[model samples]
Target: MEKIRLGKTGMMVTRLGFGGIPIQRLTEAEAVKVVQRCLDLGVNYIDTANGYTTSEERIGKAVKGRRHDVYIATKTFPGDAEMVEKNLELSLKRLDTDYIDLYQFHSVNDMDTLNRILDPENGLYRIFEKAKKAGKIRHIGITSHQMDAAKAEVKTGKFETIMFPFNFITSEPAKELLPLCREHDMGFIVMKPLAGGMLDNATLCFKYLLQFPDVVSIPGIEKIQEIDEIAAIYEGPHNITSAERKEMKRMTDELGTRFCRRCEYCQPCAQGIPISLIMTFPSFVKRLPPDWYLKGGFIPEAMEKAAECTECGECEEKCPFNLPIREMIKESYSLYEQVKAANTK
Candidate 1:
């Protein structure tokens, strides 16, 4: 039931917003039930993207009668003007709504892509502008994984909101993006607060974010218990206790600063390496179902491919966060060794 002003958008959304990704894993009826649970608990903001499989369609079915009760925000990948409009039309049809509360350009990672998308003549902004005029979308916003791109979007003063990854381990955005959002009065939509499911303690994550009441966070939901837990946080102690802080420190210390966010800006490696996936294989193995590992043999196959890095420095240069690609791949190799040893036992 707790709400905050969504910056210049002027829409007061619940601090605990609904993320649309996890619902894709559920059956259609189950997904709709999960969404209804959030809305029924007085949490009123939802975000979905075109790439999240059936997220948009499930959300559409969930809000069948009470569309006005919740504010729906969905995103589309960048495309030409016509293609962008097609995405919007399809989203509207999927959501079963004529207008969306917010429509964003999803994943504009670097300035080049940002500039191209914002280009007045050749980019998708004109299409968004036209759609805004036609009442297809009420406001325009953007989401990014890189700090540079996120900061640039805010500086342009064109977007109404900015979504970025911000958890205890990945607090780089707080250095500048947070201040810029305040200065520009742009809404801050938080994603990956749990570090893409790497952080197991959801209560700790939600409590940690309570210090920033001005921002809204959308942790992907696929269950009624998740919303109940968030509601309990709102009703319970509003600050991190000493025990909670110690637990948080332990989690962040274990995760460390070298986590790969899977941004994929460093793509198409000349050595035929999936650098992002290779770097994150350890985390994926931990978070997925137990049997997904399935003897963990092919993990070495992928890690060996990453081990072929020529140390050419090309991938590190393109990485927005300047991650040490070779070093992390080596770390992944070490982790794979441990997994391999365990499986052999």
Candidate 2:
């Protein structure tokens, strides 16, 4: 319901925008219906990516003929100039749009990658400049999970906005990244507003984030109920009551910083390990009934995958949070075994 300028880009968008990840799980018709419902409720910004499988395609289909009603921001995985151009064309076709409002360099997580992409002579940025002039994209932005990469990008002044993981538990961005965004007049778009669905207190989380006027959060949505719930949050008070504060503290204390946010950056695991889902298994068990896993479905299947892990460390290398993913997977598998043993009686 409330709007803010996305920093120097100067594009006005609502505080609660649409995150384009979770909807990839929905069918085209279901995704279209839910996304249209979200727009009808006054949420005007949608962030999608070429890497998110069917996300861009679904959003594109959902917003057909109503492009003027929302801001569509999508990211491309960094690549050579030609590859970058090809990615752009594919995005435009999939999004069914000739021009994009904000195009970001997705997951530029290290200095080497950042430097390579920013190179004027041979880097992919040249193509973005070309696209901007051609009216294919209006603004350039960057998304990163690494603090160093994000800060370097800000100093380059090449990006108009920065999307990063920010939430009550993972609040480190506030100390440096948030201020840098303010200093540079860059838009700070929060990618994991609900800490990748690990935090169940959506009401408190959204209310807490609303306290900062400069920060905009795009929590992934797939259901129409979530759309209506977020709209209600906008209408509700932003202040945290004492009970809510206590609950927030309990959650923060319980989670600390080691848990996964289910970002899926460590995907394509060499052993086909579903690292994010396995990492989130503990949280899932807690949320469900005690015997949910005892029914013997995906948990056993995932545990089989987890047990096959060679500890190749490939997933850890790609993880932005630097989590001990292999160890966590093992722990989850052990928990699964414990439940199985208990159920044998």
Candidate 3:
């Protein structure tokens, strides 16, 4: 709805880019309708990832004859040169486009991962450079769930844009990342602006984020109602009552500490469990349907595995966000067990 210069890339992307993750759950026909509605409403920036299961294919289909009108940004989780090259080709093919406006390294979390990406011999820089030369990718970018890693990447002066989680609760770090990005003339695309839908009132959050001059917030929307609501914010003055801000603060305080960001730093369970992925199930249930999770989609395989946690405190020490990993996992397991039992009848 609101338009801003996307960092150093100099493209005027709408403040509400269509985040592509949520569309993965929708059928192709449904996704097409939602995307078309977004187009009719003037929200033109579309961001997708190669990992978001058939999302690119759907976009390719939805935007078939109209691809050139919209800005397409897609990401891949490629850690090496070969993989990066492979992914780029695959993304291009899937989207039915020759060049992507922005191609980013997805879900980068640490310094080592950053180094591996920029390394000339083994990293993606060479691949990105080659792509740019060949006119396959117009700009290079990186996406990180962790602000620290994103900040580190911005310092390298290599990226045209940087994508990181930017929301009301996690905005403090932007005080640091934003200036560096502005100084370098790099674009800043924000992910998770709604705190993964925990921030229930999207209007205030969108307005709050638009006040920052150089940042763009792309809250993924799967429904036409959300598309219309976001578009409406653009036509009017962005305002939030003092009382509403207080309410937002209170709600975030209640949920911020307990919710997992899926950073996956606290891992390598002795019993081979996907702790971060399992913890996210509750949010997924809330986002989509309670039935799927209750029917066993979200149940942690760690029944005995979760019961095995000895409160060693090792995971807490490793977590970037300092999530109460063991406690949250236990809670998820218990809640899911009850839901699973109820669904059996």
What TM-score, over all chains together, does every model reach? 0.84, 0.81, 0.86
Give residue 103's error in model 3 in angstroms: 0.5
Candidate 1 versus the native: TM-score?
Answer: 0.84
RMSD of each: 5.0, 6.5, 3.6
Per-residue C-alpha lDDT of model 2 across residues 26-79, encoded as one tens digit per residue? 778998998999889999999998877688899999999999989999989897
lDDT per residue for candidate 3 within 1-345, as digits (tens), equals 557888768888877788887877788899988888877777778999887767898888888888877899999885666777888999999999988999888888888888887787757777888898999999989888766677888899989898887777766546888888888898888888887776777877787786786777777888999878877875677777788789777866887777776666776666566677666756665555444344332244534356667777787888877788878878877767776677576
The C-alpha local distance difference test score for the whole of candidate 3 amounts to 0.78
Clashing residue pairs for model 2:
none
Question: Superposing every Cα of model 1 onto the true structure, what RMSD results?
Answer: 5.0
Name the runs in model 2 displaced over 4 angstroms: 260-326, 332-345
Question: For model 1, which pairs clash?
Answer: none
Candidate 3: clashing pairs of residues: 7-187, 8-185, 8-186, 8-187
List model 1 lDDT by residue over 1-345, tens digit each: 888999898998999899988887688999999999988899899999886768999999999999998899999989676778888999999999999999999988878889898787778888888899999999899999877678899999999999998887777777788989999999999998888777878888888878787889998886799879877887688888899999988877666656776667787689988787688777655544323443344545677686688878898888877788888888877776777677667
Off by over 4 Å in 1: 261-274, 277-345
Alpha carbon RMSD to native, model 3? 3.6
Candidate 1, lDDT over the whole model: 0.84
Question: After TM-score superposition, what is the CA distance of residue 59 in candidate 1 from its true location, in Å?
Answer: 0.5
